[model samples]
Target: MATKTDDPKVLAQNRKANHDYFIEDTVEAGIVLTGTEIKSIRQGKANLRDSFVRIQSGEAWLINCHISHFEHGNRFNVDPTRTRKLLLHRTQIDKLFGQMKEKSYALVPLKIYLKNGFAKVLLGLAKGKKNYDKRQDVAKKDAQRDIDRALRDRQKY
Candidate 1:
């Protein structure tokens, strides 16, 4: 149950983004949504998995994001997977475009949240991670967990 509070309420997040890519930078941008779309999102029926951001002709668009149909919205319901516009400044879009042209950079949607009664997306400028990198990360995490568990047991004894 989400209540209206000053803090932003996260509606959806891409958990695999951190595992598949190395996020270099993040930018927050407003997302355009229809009546039903907003309602669906407020109910936490949005999915950021496998969704991405694209800058084309100086405009940013969110592609492949899914927002389930609102239960009460009949005729107003639209395509759940429709492309949506992302509002960003021209300078920011140009910066991302230039960086993308230079390397294997990608724009991944990291999170979708509601702030100040508007929908916002946190876009991550990321580079793809190799399989070896993922393995190393997992190994490090396992080691850290083992060490913490050992210390906790020692304190109990």
Candidate 2:
């Protein structure tokens, strides 16, 4: 069978979440999708940026994610940015809800990948970083890069 280049292993990712928050914990969650939605995702047309998870009435919901319409779906395609449900265990949902009650804690989607013919999202339990905190992280990364470069140069000499 011929493989399609569009069937992305990691369909979508949210890189900004790392820079904006301190991820304390992560959870893998199954996502609910329509036929067309899954096809669109497989086409690498999904976006996880600006998406977030929320627990309401004991249910986990994914909001603000966008999955492009399938070209051949026609009437079967749903809204690209519609809210979607996330599948998680009851205890897990409860725990997340409690954690979310904290002022600084937020739920962010780190990435989404196709596993075993299913779509799964990596959710991050993150605490928002302050402006100075972000600056410090940037500085630390810069320092690390400089150190690595120096080590490489020393090895070459």
Candidate 3:
């Protein structure tokens, strides 16, 4: 048996959000998780696609994230895609709410990682990228890859 550090944990990730949004800033927040939920997460059975954050009544919540129930979890298992609450300070919530009011800023979950035996969600304040911006980013990545390939090839000479 491995320790928590070696625990196969990674509940969910939002890969599409990264592709569609330009991540401006990120914040790590604690998630309200249940026993069975934790088991499922440790098994890597969660999805963060289509999830978004909404602040209401001075609290932040994550919506549309799907954390599948553990197979042997029985009746105690909760819904997979339940709206989960996020733990954050009031000032941070207020600041995020203000930024969300802007037309471009959107809330996105970057990754889920286990820290100190607790589950943590890495959230991002993102701005949607225009089509051209995405194309330019792709082109830049391609160019960088080419440069790396060229340098590696040079090393062989």
Which model scores highest in TM-score? 1
Q: What is the C-alpha RMSD of each candidate to the true structure, in Å?
A: 2.1, 3.1, 2.4
If both were scored by lDDT, which would come out higher, candidate 1 or candidate 2?
Answer: 1
Q: Write the per-residue lDDT of candidate 3 for residues 1-157, one digit (tens) a residue.
A: 7555645246678888877998989998999999999888888887888889988888999999899889999999998999899999888898888988965598889888788688889999999988998899889999999999999999999
Can you rank all candidates by lDDT, best first?
1, 2, 3
Worst 10 residues of 1 by lDDT: 1-10
- Candidate 2 vs 3: which has more TM-score: 2
List candidate 1 stretches off by more than 4 Å.
1-5
Q: What's model 1's TM-score?
A: 0.95
lDDT of 1 by residue, 21-68 (tens): 999999999999999999999999999998998888899999999999
Model 3: how far is 74 from its true place, Å?
1.0
Q: Tell me the TM-score of model 3.
A: 0.91
Q: Candidate 2 at 149: error in angstroms?
A: 0.9
RMSD of 2: 3.1
Per-residue lDDT, model 1, residue 44, is: 97
Clashing pairs in 3: none
Model 3 C-alpha RMSD to native: 2.4
Please give each candidate's TM-score.
0.95, 0.92, 0.91
lDDT of 2 by residue, 1-157 (tens): 7454545378899999999999999999999999999999888899988899988899999999989999999999899999999999999998888888965589999998987778999999999999999999999999999999999999998
**What's model 2's TM-score?**
0.92
Decide which is better by TM-score, 1 or 2: 1
